[model samples]
Target: MAFDERALVRGPQPAVPEIVPYDDGWPDRFEQHRRRIAVALGSRAHEVEHIGSTSVPGLGAKDVVDVLVVLDDPDDEAAYLTDLERAGYELRVREPGHRALRETSGRRVNVHCYAAGDDEITKYRLLREHLRAHEDARRTYEDAKRALAGREWPDMNHYAEAKGPTIHRLLREAGWTGAL
Candidate 1:
C-alpha cells in the first residue's frame, strides 16, 4: 500500500506531539520490550531489531523505541498478538502490505513485524548501520532531530518528513541507495 506521504508535507494538521529527548535508557527499554515480544512471537518471529532514534546512543529523540521484527510468515502475526497482548503490547497501527505493527502500553515503542525477506526491515537496518558507522552523519542526524523536535508539526509522520531531506542527504553520502 502507498503511504500517505502527503500526510506529512501538506496542509494544516493536528498539532505534533511533544518530543522529549532523553538519555541512553532507550535501548534498555527496547531490550525489555524485545524479550516480551520474542516470547510472544515464538518460532514465527525470525529476528527483532532496534530501529529509530532511541536505538542510537546520544541522539535526541522523541523518546520512542522503534523495533522491527522479521517473521517467518508475516500473515501469522495474529498468533503472536495474543501473546503480545498478554505481554502488554497493543495493536496500534496496521499497514497491511508492509507489516503488522504494535506499540507498547506506555506508548513509548513502535514494534514492527514483517515477513522474513522483506526489504523494509533490511533498509531500516542498513540506514541504522550507516549512521552508526559514520560519526558525522550520526551527529548531523541528531542535530536535525533536535531542531525539528521544536517545531509543532501535525504528527510524528510530519516531523519525520521534515527531517527527510537531511536524512536523504546523509543516506546518499553513506552510499545508501535503498528505498526510504
Candidate 2:
C-alpha cells in the first residue's frame, strides 16, 4: 500500500509546535494510559513504554504523553488498530513501518506503534534511558528544544524534522553505536 505522507497532517497546519514546561503529572498520566492500552491490545502488545520528552523528569516538553507500543506484527493493523479505536485512539499517520494515533479522551497523546525488533524502537529506548541517566545531556536537549520551539514552523512535521540534527548528536554523545 502506498502511504500518503500528507495525510499525517491533521487539521490546519500549526504555525509552530507547541512546547511547554514539563509537568510533574506527566508520568502518572502515562501510566494511566499505558494500562488502558495494555488492556486494549492484550497479548499483541509485547511492550508498551513511556517515551519522548515527557518520560524524562525535569525536561521541558510539549504537553503530550508519547507512548511506544511494540507489537509482534505492527503491519497487521487489523489485529490491533480496531482495538485502539475502541479504546478511543484515532489513527493519524500510517507510514511504511510505523503508525501514529491520537487519543480522543481530552488528554493529549501520541501512541507510536512499531513491530518488535524494529531499530527505531531501540533508538527511542536508548535516547530515553540516556537522557534519564545523564543530567548534562538532558539539559542540553531541553535548551535546544526551547530554542527550536520559538522558531516558526510550517507544520508539526517540519518542527519535528528540525530537531533531527540535535537528536542525532545527543544520541552519539550517549554512546549509541548506530546498531539496532
- lDDT per residue for candidate 1 within 6-125, as digits (tens), equals 422233345455456556688898998888788877767678889977776656677778988776665565656677668776655455534434464567787777877777676677
Q: Which of the numbered candidates is closest to the native, going by highest lDDT?
A: 2
Pick the TM-score winner. 2
* CA lDDT of each prediction against the hidden true structure: 0.69, 0.83
lDDT of 1 at 173: 78
Which residues of candidate 2, in runs, are more than 4 Å off? Answer: 1-4, 7-12, 105-107
Score residue 113 of candidate 2 by CA lDDT.
Answer: 93
Off by over 4 Å in 1: 1-22, 75-77, 100-104
TM per candidate comes to 0.80, 0.89
| Residue pairs in clash, model 1 | none
TM-score quality measure for candidate 2: 0.89
Worst 10 residues of 2 by lDDT: 1-10
